[model samples]
Target: MWLYAGRRIVLTIPILLGVTIICFALVQIAPGDPIQNLLSPTATAQDAARLRAAYGLDQPLMVQYFIWLGKVCVGNLGMSISDNVPVAGEVLHAFVNTIVIALISVVLAFVVSMIFGVIAAYRTGSLADRLITAVAVFGISVPPFWLGVILVIFFAVDLSWLPATGMGASGSETFSYFRWADFKFAIMPIIALALPPLGIMTRTTRSSIAEILNQDFIQTLRAKGLSEAQVIVHAVVNIMPQAVAMLGLQLGYLIGGSVLVETVFTWPGTGYLLNKAVLTRDIPLLQGTILVLATAFVLINLVVDLAQSLIDPRLKRS
Candidate 1:
């Protein structure tokens, strides 16, 4: 397991580097010059030239990339052209916010999926099963932004059950675990972000449980007079490794999707921060945000791989 984990960890470096290269190239080669945008509208050609030199934009592309890469390695993400804030500070702060939102969303998704999945599998072709299936399908099909708007209109606008914008009450910067207002503010966005993954997980769990039930061992257990609950639990335990692996990957997707959901809901999360940075061409913040996200995804995949090996010994064998 250690060897496998080490291999996975080693592989993450190149994958992250590749992502950086592609993102950097796209940002650099894209049609707008950050320096040009920063200058006065009536500025002379020499003004543009000085701004270019100031930001080292006049250097060769490769040289510029190396300079940026060096800065990144040493923990300097560069300054935001728009705000002049340290890139690391802004990105790290946004990342911490994103993590809080992502964790809540994952917990909600897992709990909801497990309950519905077990019900659908146990009830099989009953009306309850059909309803669960339909709900899952709808959850999976709906775009998060659209869902966010509908939720805001119904829950926030009409009912006034929750706040429609921001992470918390207007001036509350630091979060509090015991605050009802903060929790209520987080719910709508978490629900919208979690829906698709919850749906997918429910379907996967239902199918996996059903398949396990058909196995000879399950039939033998039934013949031996095992209770249905006991049998189901045993089957779920056996297939849980695969389900866990699926959850890991899905969690990564959920985190990424939260960006869009947060944007639509006007929630203050890493996703929303990244979107704002991109619009304003905050290169340092953009690079930091994307790198952090990619790193998280890679780490999630690695953890899942290790978990699979632990759950199923055969996975670690030839």
Candidate 2:
């Protein structure tokens, strides 16, 4: 098990390097100069050239990449051109915000989806199953941003039960833990981030469970006089490898979706930070943030792989 985990971690090195190349390339191709962001409207051609030179933007792309890569290797995430502060701190802050929202959202989505999926599977063609499946389909189809807007209008503005946007209190900048006011603010955004993935998981679970129920072992267990509930509980446990694997996939989706959800909700997560970075063209900040998110994605999959192996020891042998 340790060896398998070690192998996965070692493999992430190349993937991380490739991610850096792709992220850097895409950002470079994007229009709008970070230099333009640096200069005032009245700045002259000389000033533009000087600023470019100062920032080494005049250097070949490859050179600039290597320079940034070198700094990244030494624990420096580089400085924000706009604020001239260490990008590491800002990136870390945003990373924390994202983890808080993403973690809760992922777990809640996974558990709820499993329960709903099981209920739907049991009911099969009944009205209850139809309603559950329809809800899941609607969740899968609805764009999270639109859902977020609707939720904000209905729950925050009209009902006044929750705050519309932002992650903190009247004066506090970010949420550290569960505080009633900020937690209330987070509820809507979390629901927004969870729904799409939850919907996908529900559909997948219902299908997987249906398949498991038809298996020979399930029939054998039924023949042994086990109740349907007992057999289903066993089947659910047996089917967990696939469910856990899906968790990794859904987690990736949820993290990516949080970008839009955060924006709509004005949540102070990495997605919101990322939006600001693009507007200001904070290259180093963008680079660092993308790298961190990529690292998280890889790590989440690794953990899921290990979990599968643990759940089904045959996976470890393979």
Candidate 3:
């Protein structure tokens, strides 16, 4: 198991470097001059040249990439063009906000899916099963951005039960946990991010569990005079590794989907931050944010792989 984990860890180094290269390349080739943001309308040609030279924009692209890469290797992410602050610190702060929102969304999705999925499996073909299937289908089919808009219109506009936007009370800079207001602000975004994954997980879990029940082991256990509940408990335990694996994929979806959900709800997270960076064409900041997000997504899947190996020894062979 440790060997497998070590192998996975080693493999991730190249993948991360590849991601970094692609991120750097995309930013370099993007059409607009990043230095434009620094110039005033009244600035002279020398001012433009000076700013370009200062940023090393006059150098070869590969040289700039290697310089940036060197800084990244030494725990420096450089500075943001938008605010002139440390890019690493800003990205880390944004990551914290994103994790809080995304993790909660993931948990909610997992719980909701497992419960409904299990019920649908147990009730197979009943009215409850049909209703669950319908709702799960609807949840999966609806786009998060559209759903978020509808929810904002209904709850925030018409009902006024929840705030339409923002991470917390007005003018708040950081989120404080355990505060009802903060959680209150997150509710809609959470729901928007959670629904599609919840639906997919529910469908998959139901199908997987149902398939597991048909296996010879399940029949043997039943023949041994185990109660239905006992048989189900056994099935659930056997299915946990599958669930863990599926959760990892769903987590990736949550992170990707956050860009849309955060934008619709104006939640102050990395996704929102990325949107701002793009609009402002802040290349240094954009590269840093994407790199951090990609790293997080990769690390999460690594944990999932390790967890699956721990839960099911058979996976270690693969």
Best candidate (score: lDDT):
3
List ranges where model 3 is wrong by over 4 Å. 170-174
Candidate 3: tens digits of C-alpha lDDT, residues 73-126: 887887889899998988888788788778888888888888888889988999
Q: Candidate 3: global Cα-lDDT? A: 0.86
State the lDDT of candidate 1 residue by residue for 8-119, as single tens digits: 7888889878877876787776676677668789999999998888888899989988898888888888887888898777777777777777777777777788788888
- lDDT string for model 2 (1-318, tens) is 899878877887898888778877877988878888888999999999998889778999999899878887887888888779898888878787788778888788889989989988877998878988998998899999999999999998899998888765553354545678668877998899888878888998899888888889998999999999999898798879999999888887666557888899888778887888877889878878887787778888878988998898888877
Alpha-carbon deviation at 93 in model 3, angstroms: 1.2
TM-score attained by model 3: 0.94
Per-model clash counts, in order, read: 0, 0, 0
lDDT of candidate 2 vs native? 0.84
Whole-model lDDT values for every prediction: 0.81, 0.84, 0.86
Q: All candidates: CA RMSD in angstroms?
A: 1.9, 1.8, 1.7
- Whichever of 1 and 2 has more TM-score, that candidate is 2
Full-model lDDT, candidate 1: 0.81
Q: After best superposition, candidate 3 residue 141: deviation in angstroms?
A: 1.1
